[model samples]
Target: MDFASLMTKEISKAKPSDTKDKKETGSNNKYQRRADVEAARIAAYNAEQEKLQREREEKAALKRKHEEDELERRREREEKKRKLAEESRKKREAEEEAAERQRRKRLGLPELPPRASEEGTPVPEEEDIDDEELIKKLRELNEPATLFAETHKARLKRYRKLVKRSLTPQLSNGPIPTTLELVPEKDMKIPAKIPKDIDPESRKFLFRQLASYFTMLLEEWAIALAKRDTSVKESFSGRQAFNAMVQSRDNMRPLFKKFETGDIDHTVLEAIVEIVHCAQERRYVDANDGYLRLSIGKAAWPIGVTMVGIHERSAREKLHESDNKAHIMSDEVTRKYLQSIKRCLSFAQVRWPPDDLLQLMG
Candidate 1:
């Protein structure tokens, strides 16, 4: 009985103590679970934040790449355009150079050599003749005069008729027939014999004498013209006189020949008088001395015998004085006079006396 009672009391005390230890252990486990839960929540929040940051970085990188791509495309387009423009310019230049070469070939022009120094250096090439040089050469050839005479002889005859109409009075008798006639090439006679004895000096003398005689005849014609028309004394202009004289084939022909030979003779004086008379008739010369009178017959008579150059002191002086007198007239008158004189001189410079004596005299 005693042993069984003691064992039961000890067992009951041990049970109570074991129950208390179990309760304390359970409380400590609860605390540990709560702490673990809080830690897990914090880790999840941090992971979410890191994910968002990564997405943001990736988006930024994509945007930057797009901008770079756009810039690259723009740069590529500009480069292409520049290249195309350069190519076009080069092609145009090549075409222009080819065209120029073709034009030169067509014109039979030689290719120019390149200059050693490109700056300001002319290419070595043949040049075309200048216009002035061409004109001078043509004048030297005297082809223009010959052609003009051949083509315009009828016109010259018409001009002569007009001069006669203006300068001559209506006579009781009808108009006189012209002594001169244009001989056709078919009718022209060839010389039967050549004069072997005639030296150059003698030929020149004879030609000069012939010219003088022609001039003398022209002077007589001018005097006759002046006497026939009283209107020449009434109204006179230098330009009108010059024009009238120029219009007459008979009066102008001798002067034209003299001018061609660079000879001013009595005939030249008569021509000048005719010019003055015509001018006076036109009322261009308003000077006090009755329109600057010049005697063609008197001035030219000495040239026939003197065997001197036609452009002697007397003729030159008279011409100069007459020209000076003409200058004082109206501007229109002066201009016409100068133009007429130029035309006459030009004609004379190229005209030649005929080879035949009769033709030369006419």
Candidate 2:
């Protein structure tokens, strides 16, 4: 092969190699550009992902906070309801206790002395009284009617005259005498001035007869009170009705004062009043209309006494019932009753009688 031809072939070969090298370099450049673009796109995608992740985390935290807040609110509402229920339960029990105490008191049950087994028993650690000393004290206090026989006889005569005058039909229109005397049992004597119509047996009746009449009067008064009616009429003669009312008010002053000061419970007062009224009538009064009608005389007294006893027993039983069924009374009701009673006692001047007369009055 000629030298030119060899040179030409080498040139051609060189040209082909140069062209291939260029193509390869171009491809590498294009690849590098594509790689750069891809890198930039990847970086952008990564950054966007990071932002999206942050946003998702924030959303999850917000959801968690909202759920926590809702749970807290629900818990607070339940707690409030529980507290209200507890308070209501306590109030009801107090009212029931007050009512029971009043009923027992009104029925004339002996004022319940503190129990010996309770913390405040009055028993001494050792006995201090001797049988001999007790007998001496009793003997000293005793005195026979014989010591004043003559004075007693005169007094008895006067008492009989007074009683006769008081009971006489003619004297009914007149005012009752302020002072009264008692007749002695020994003076079974009829007065010289006794009416011709008077029987010897009737005249001989002593203070026992007067006591019986007084008991009858007491029964009548109790019946009137129970019925919420006055014994005296609007046009009745003299001030007897007024005087009786005044006396009742005076007797009940202590109780009224205690109620006013909130020292006494209202439930107790109401129960006592109801019991007394029922006992007086020898029957339960209609609570709705407040009506009571009782028969008069000796037989009624026994009935009244029996009814009073029943009331007292019922009151004691109620105390036990309340304790066993504590949930029955709502605390709110109990508190309301207590508060109402306190206000009524303080503002209203209602009378309450002495303990000694409670049984008789009923």
Candidate 3:
């Protein structure tokens, strides 16, 4: 073979290999470009997510700030309202004091002394009694525990005066002044039992008499309550008591109607008799307790029944007491009547705030 021909063959083989290498290089460049594009897309997506997260955090922070601001504004408004109310109350009290003083001056009465604590010297801390303790002491002395529009300081001062008055007896032969005068209760008898064979007209007349008697008793109770002092006679407390009494009188109308019709149950009749008798005797505490029994009933005790084991099943029924009063409120009509009676008792309690007279005697 010629030398030139052999050189040509080698060159041709080299040419094919070079072309193949160029194609592979182009493919690698294409793959690298695709990879770069994918990485850029992922970075953009991450940046968008980060931006959204930041925006959400900013909104949450702003919302919290708004709520905090609103709460602070509400507190400020309430505080302002309280301050205004306090100012108004003080102004009213001052005006009332001035008017009272002017009235006293016009009457040519001696100038009222300043309040104990209002004098140049403050009351000794040691002498300051808790309001509850002061109320209890006042009750023990048979004095009214509280008066309408009376402050704790005034109450304490009054209590001290009462204590001093009691401890120091007057050497002069003058009777001690008392705010409350005991009024004797008028005598009244409740029938032991309603006659089972009584005619409807007789029953109606009897119930009407009983209702009139009950009303009279309540009226007497109010008169006694208002005998405390001039201030008490016109006080809101006294008004409340009178209003409660009026409501109670209204409540008893339906009950008396039932009694007249002979539709009242025996338990109800017994309860009414007991309640009226207690009121008549001024055993208000007992009367209130009786009313509670009539209203709620004695079906279940304040103490709940204990669960018995299977072995003690026979003793389960024995655990509770058998009571006729349990079935007193058998029907809805009876329940309504009792509920009304309960309100009447509440009125009586308010009118004559029960004293522990029985306990004291025992």
Candidate 4:
């Protein structure tokens, strides 16, 4: 019985040790499960972070591409606008230049380029270069080497012309040059000075208006003159004579009667004579008296007329009156006389009339 009881106690103690080992094993398994769950949660977080980062990078790349495309389009638009503006400017300039040329042509003046006078480049001298060198230079300037069998002297002249053309760039496109003599400004025609009381701008305006009026008168006279027959200019009954009377404001007979009766105003006669005198070129002679002497023109003169008094030299002198001369005039003489007056009036406006010479040149 005692042996059996001891064996039972030993078995009981062994059972307790086994129970403690099983409990320890269960605690270890619980700890392992918690570690595995934590690892899985951390891994899932890392994957989500990576996915978000990739999405953000893709969005940034798309935004940059859109911005670059927008910039490119904007640059293209600006370039097109600039080109159009440049073309418009060039077209306007060309049109203005053409109009200016036409105006100068009508004025019987040279068509000069814009700011031509500002270019002070000297013309190349022909004497400085030989023919071979000159030919090369001409080619460089896009000019012909020589004009049809031109002489050496002619070539030199041509070279000078080319040099002048190159230097000026704005040479006038005028008709054949006139043979009119160039008078010195101070010694030739003196411009009328502005009176102290006169407004300069107003005077200038009046002068321009008067000039325009004179141009109209010239056109009217030209139309009348065109009808005149060239063959019988000297005949009293010729078309030329008839047209001359027709050209006058009224028939000149009344004017002659007024002159004979000494009834015409001095200002009216002076104005008439002043207009006629413009046809003839005269120099300013400091020594001469105020009276301008008259010489008979090609027209047949009336009998026994020594001279026709024109300008009033002083207060006592009366011009364009028949008080001191023969009053008879045929249609032929009258025609030429009126024509001379018209010629004077037809002359262009000049800046040489004195301030005191009112209505003398307008």
Candidate 5:
């Protein structure tokens, strides 16, 4: 009994100490849990902050790239605009230069130097050259060494004029005179004696040359007509004359075709020469009359039909006019040629005054 009682007392004393130790352990555990929760919260907040910072950096970098691209596009546009403007300027300058050259040529002046050559040395003035050098230059230009009764200043002036004239560009064949002489009737007429062995090409070339001279004569006649004092009331006649000339040129095409085939007609050539000669001499009345005669012959009937017994005896006794008509004009190809010549005659009669009255009118 005594031993059991003592053991029970000892257990009762150990129970309080066990209870205190359990309480302390529980408090320590609770403190450790609080500290762990705080540490985890701090780590999560730091991670969130780092993520936000990275997003901000990406946004700033993207904005900077976009700005750089925009700037590059703007620069490209400006460069293209500058290039177009420069090209337009160069084209305009070239056209203006060409117009200036044409104007100078028309005015009978020396052409301006090309843009590339403008920077080169300029031509020396007449005053800059001495007498000996001037004489040498004159010889080179094939000009007279000196003029009779000419002073030094006068000689230099003459040299300058000659040099300037030489500077003008020459035609490939030669310089064409401003005023060309009228083609002679003999030249206009086809040759009487033809070479038997002449080539077709040579004959055609000869015909073309003759046609060109004919055209030149017409141009000279037109120039003379322009120089004359004409009335404004005759403008309609002038227009009609111009139309007739255009039609005549077209009509001549058939004649040219015939000539090309070596079918030479001297009668037609003589008629044309007569008309051209009259026009060149300013004898428009005679020219018009000749044109009418060539266009319409004096024959009453084109077909050879004599007056019958039903006709009056006086008609039978009447003498027939000469049969020198160009029957070729009645052909289908040349029918329109006569018509155009007739129209020209009609206009010429109204437009040109008589030779006697021309001087008074002028």
Candidate 6:
């Protein structure tokens, strides 16, 4: 081959390679421009989306703020309406009260009592009120007449409070809840001891309440007797000789036996009431004691002597005049009996109006 021909062939091959490299470079430049354009478009789209989201958030915040303002305004308006209604109600009440006073004056009816002092009316310190009435009022108030160791003045004040509370239906119907103490069962073991930790004051208060309940039971018994036998009168009596009279009476066995058992059932209590009623009426004595030779139960304990006698040289000595007729049982046996009686008084269940008590006598 000629040298020129060889150079020409090599030049042609070199030219083709260079053209291919230029074409590749141009293609790469075009791809890079497209990538840049895509990146710019992605950035712009992201920015636009963020702007829209920000606008939506701002709009939501504005709406919430508007709603909050509306709620606040509504609350303020409601409060204002309530205040106005309250003021109007007060005005109406005052007008009605004034009209009532005028009407009372015109009708010659007794007007309402004067308002109490600004400091409040002071209750009278009178202790001369009837005990029955005071106690009855206390019972109605669901209060213990002897709850606290208060002075006569304080007691009177309590009574006044009861009266005031009675005016309010809610307070009167809703009785002051009192807790009942569950008495421990009497035990035979080692002379059962009351726990010292038990509050004595509370025990005493409970006993005081129980005493009232017992008295109520007695009253119910009396009422039962009245219903059972209309021939008897309600008269209070205390007698020592009656015990013998009761023991001697053949019919008294069943009734007195119940008391001995300390099983205070309605039937027994009712029977006792009848017995007491008959004795007070002098029916038992007249029916029995056929002859003077017959002594009912150990020559019949002494009769015709007044009890609760004042002993000589005692604090009550000056309180009573010397009367030989006045009788007293100061022996240890009598003292023990008194204690038992006191205990009995402290323990009584409340069952009133006969039939109701009959259901719960035990």
* Clashes per model (N, Cα, C within 3 A): 18, 13, 0, 11, 0, 0
Per-candidate alpha-carbon RMSD to the true structure: 35.1, 33.5, 25.0, 29.0, 25.3, 25.3
TM-score of each: 0.26, 0.22, 0.34, 0.25, 0.31, 0.27
Top candidate on TM-score is: 3
* Alpha carbon lDDT at 29, candidate 3: 75
Per-residue accuracy of model 4 over 1-362 as CA lDDT, tens digit each? 69999999999989988999999998887666778889999999999999999999999999999999999999999999999998998899788888888888999888765644435543467455677987887888888888898965677678878889767524211111112222222333213333446574543333333233333444455555556667665566676544543454343334434433445544334433333233223322210111122222223333554454975334233333443332123356544434444443333223233333343532
lDDT of 1 by residue, 1-362 (tens): 69899999889989988999998998787656767889999999999999999999999999999999999999999999999999998799778878878888899998644326446554234533344554454455443322344433333344445546657633211021222222232332222222557675643443433334333333444554566456654566644654565455343444334433545543333444444333223222221122233211122223345435766554545533433343324354333433444333323322432233332211
What overall lDDT, based on C-alpha atoms, would model 4 receive against the true structure?
0.51
Among all windows of 10 consecutive residues in model 4, the one with the lowest summed lDDT is 171-180
Give the C-alpha lDDT of model 3.
0.67
What TM-score does candidate 6 get on C-alpha atoms? Answer: 0.27
**Model 5 residue 166 CA deviation in Å:** 30
TM-score of 3: 0.34
* Candidates sorted by lDDT, best first: 3, 5, 4, 1, 6, 2
Best candidate, lDDT: 3
RMSD versus native structure for model 6? 25.3
Model 6: how far residue 99 lies from native, Å? 1.5
Model 3 residue 147 CA deviation (Å) reads 62
Candidate 5 lDDT, 184-295, residue by residue in tens? 5455554433455768665665565445444554454456456655673268877665555666657756654554455756556556556655654556666666666676
Per-residue CA lDDT of model 3 for 159-257, tens digit only, reads: 989988987733321111212122223434556456779786655555654555555545655566667787775889977766765655555556655
